[model samples]
Target: MEPAADMETASASTSTSASASASASASASASASASASATAAVGAMMDGRLLQENALSWPEVQEICKELEHLYRKDAQKDAARVRALARKRKEISAACQEKKNTAQQQLNQLLGNVREWEQQSNTAKARRDELAKKLQELEALKREMVAQLERVRVDEQSSKESLERLLDTYETARQEALKFQLEHRNEIDRAKHFMSLYAAVTGIKWDFSGDSIAGEIHIPRTQEIVPFEIDSTQSNDFETANALWAKIDAAFDALDNNDEL
Candidate 1:
């Protein structure tokens, strides 16, 4: 019975050793598969990061996804559908992320474009304002010049008017003086005419005046003789002689008159 017990113990120990070895082999296999799955997950994470970092085109991203699907199918046959589905989900996630990034980039581009346009418009407005300011300055200068010129013209006109008025006053004075002289001269001439007519009618002699002297020739009545005589009224000291000569003429004229009456 002891020998049988020893054999039974040996068989039990052998079965236990076989079971321990099989268990160790299965655990190692499982560990390797877990490590491979972990490595593949890490690789997929790195590939996803790479895809995210690079600005790849859509076709390039699609080709990379197909390659990852093929690799996943070869690595995990039993979980092929799940791996394919995960790859498809990753592709969709990448596409969504890429689309979101593209939308953000487009929005940034539009904002930049708007800013540029606004800057351009601001520059244009500034230029227009500067041009208007320049024109206003020129207009102000022109107005000042015009005002100055008008003042000068006014001054010139005032000066000319004053001069013309002075000339008119001078001409008026000259004309008045000329008219007074003419009137005095005409009165002198009329007095001289009246004296000459009185002398001729009263003395019965044709007389002519030379300055202040009188000269005439007279015919004696009933005689064929004429007497010529001259008198100088300008000689004041010879007035007595002039009176004697006039008395003699009167006597001769009286004798002639008596003879004519007889």
Candidate 2:
């Protein structure tokens, strides 16, 4: 009985030692598993926090947005510059067109002025031609009047020449008839001279006969002074012969007075 109790007591001590060793190994495994789970939970919490920061308030996103804004501003500035250049080019083209139009207008005005000057010159030439034509007509009329007057003067000169010739012919005929009548009456004149001589003896006067004339010497009854007298009878009328005879007697009396005074 004593041996059996001692064995049983040894067995009991071994079993307890085994049980304690197993329990210690299990406790170590549980602790290791718990540590792995805690590490996993912490890793998940950190990943969630990182996702929230990226969505709401990350510095890299803010920097990216600022860079995009800068690019947009640069593009806008380039567009504005292009627009300004286009506007400046359009303004230059319009200014060139306006200057060209002004030059064309000036040329048209000069052409119109030249045409007006030419028309004025033509009008002046026409008026001068009209005046020259009028002067020619007046000269022709005056020449015709002068020609008519010359023709009338020629006709009057011809008539006067004919009348003068007729008057000369009549004068020549009258002179010839007077000379013939004096020759035909020569005998009658001699008989008259003889009777005159007989009367002169009684009247105390001497008589002498010449061609168409008589000459005599007479004695004055109161003083016995002798006087010479002459008479011309070549005219056709008695009044002409009587006036010539009386003029001769008056001349003889004047000679007698002059002799008495001497």
How many collisions per candidate?
0, 0
Judge candidate 2 against the unseen true structure and give its global Cα lDDT, from 0 to 1. Answer: 0.65
* Per-residue lDDT of candidate 1, residues 97-116 (tens digit): 56555655666677788889
Residue ranges of candidate 2 with Cα displaced over 4 Å: 1-100, 175-262
lDDT of 1 at 163: 97
- lDDT tens digits by residue: candidate 2, 48-155: 756785464567556655655665566457556655654564455456445544554555566677779989999999999999999989999999998898888888
| Candidate with the greatest TM-score versus the true structure | 1
Assess every candidate by TM-score. Answer: 0.39, 0.37
lDDT of 1 at 239: 72
